[model samples]
Target: MSTVTTRTVAYPADGLTMIGHLALPAGDDRRPAVLVGPEGPGLNDFQRGRAESLAELGYVALAFDINGGRWFTDPGEMLARVTPLLADPDRMRDIGHAALDVLLAEPRTDPDRIAAVGYGTGGAIALELGRDGVDLRAIGTVNALTTGRPGEAARIRCPVWAGVGSEDPIMPPAQREAFTAEIEAAGVDWRLVVYGGALHAFHHPPVDQAVVPGVGYHPRHARRAWRDVVDLLDECVPVPG
Candidate 1:
């Protein structure tokens, strides 16, 4: 196995310091990069692990903290910070663009092969990044709904893959159908995988019910989801020469 290294990078965003955890292969080859956005507010352990896993797969992965260390589960705080960003398309675009720039500037990363992955709230940001013409090789989202004006799907330029739980109440069957129709209408390549008997937050196995109040995971789906993500990365962001 190739050596792996993890580091903390501080990048400027909105005049504030945004801390990100970056993982990369230790060789001289400039590998493709993946930018991971967190689910709710700030950086978490799960996102960090994702970066490490990506690095192990021969890619330079940066897990960006969009919330700038601020997180709130309470309805009021959620509305004040997360909801507004979700409602406004421009804010999400700016945040994603800034982080993409930071990752692109990394010497060990391949800018052209970059991709984005997010969970829940972070997933929505990833969707917006693709919708805003990031030129990403591919985009992956876990348990996120359509965001930033319904018709924004027409702006996507890369293949998109979404993983959702069949039992997730928030992402009901009807909602999934609407999301699919819009993406299909946009003429972008997209796929939605619904894991049977799984609830929200299925990717993080150990964290199924610990972090989020209502989410419990399905072990089988979690394993399969990880494989699917790795396969997507392998296909879209091949190792550099």
Candidate 2:
């Protein structure tokens, strides 16, 4: 395994200081970069680990924060913080852009070859960035089947890949249909993978905190989803050898 270095980064968004985890691969050459967004609760170890794993695969990865670097153990607290953010697309874009700036500032990042991968609330933010006309090479999201404002998705210029559990109540069939319809209407290249018999947050590992109803961890599907996201990045933003 190549040596991957990680560091803490702080940036401002939504009138608060947000902390992000940045991981760099062991190479001096410019590399494809990825921006990682965490679930609603906040950026946790799982997301940070994902950034590290991407770096190990020879990409510059940054796991950006959504909630001022705080993690919520209570479901109500998590929803309280994330609900308002979800309701406002502009706010989501502000957050996403701030983190993106941090990623682009790194010398190792090939600014022209960058992608975004996010989970849950973070995933929604990634989508918002695409809708905001950010020039991303690719976008990959999990457990987030959110629709953008009317005609906004037309701004997206990259391929998008989304993964969701079939049984996810938060992103039910109707929501998924709406999301796909919007993407299709915008003429974006997109793909959706439905993991059978899984629930919301299936990509997450078992956490010590109390989660809301209908969210559970599915180990097999979690690994599979990671592989799929990696494949998406490989296809869309390959690093030169």
Residue-wise lDDT of candidate 1 within 104-168, one digit each (tens)? 88899877789888887778888988888778998888888674566678888888889999998
Q: In model 1, how many backbone clashes occur?
A: 0
lDDT (0-100) at residue 2 of candidate 2? Answer: 52
What digit string (tens of lDDT, one per residue) describes model 2 on residues 1-241? 4599999999999998999999999969999999999999999888899999999999999999999989988899999999999999999999999999999999999999999999999999999999999999999999988998999999999999999999999999999999999999999999999999999999999888986789999999999999999999989998676
Clashing pairs in 1: none
Show where candidate 1 strays beyond 4 Å.
14-16, 71-80, 205-213
Top model by TM-score, which number? 2
Q: Quantify all predictions' global Cα lDDT against the true fold.
A: 0.80, 0.95
Model 2: residues with Cα > 4 Å off, grouped in runs: none
Q: Each prediction's TM-score against the native?
A: 0.90, 0.98
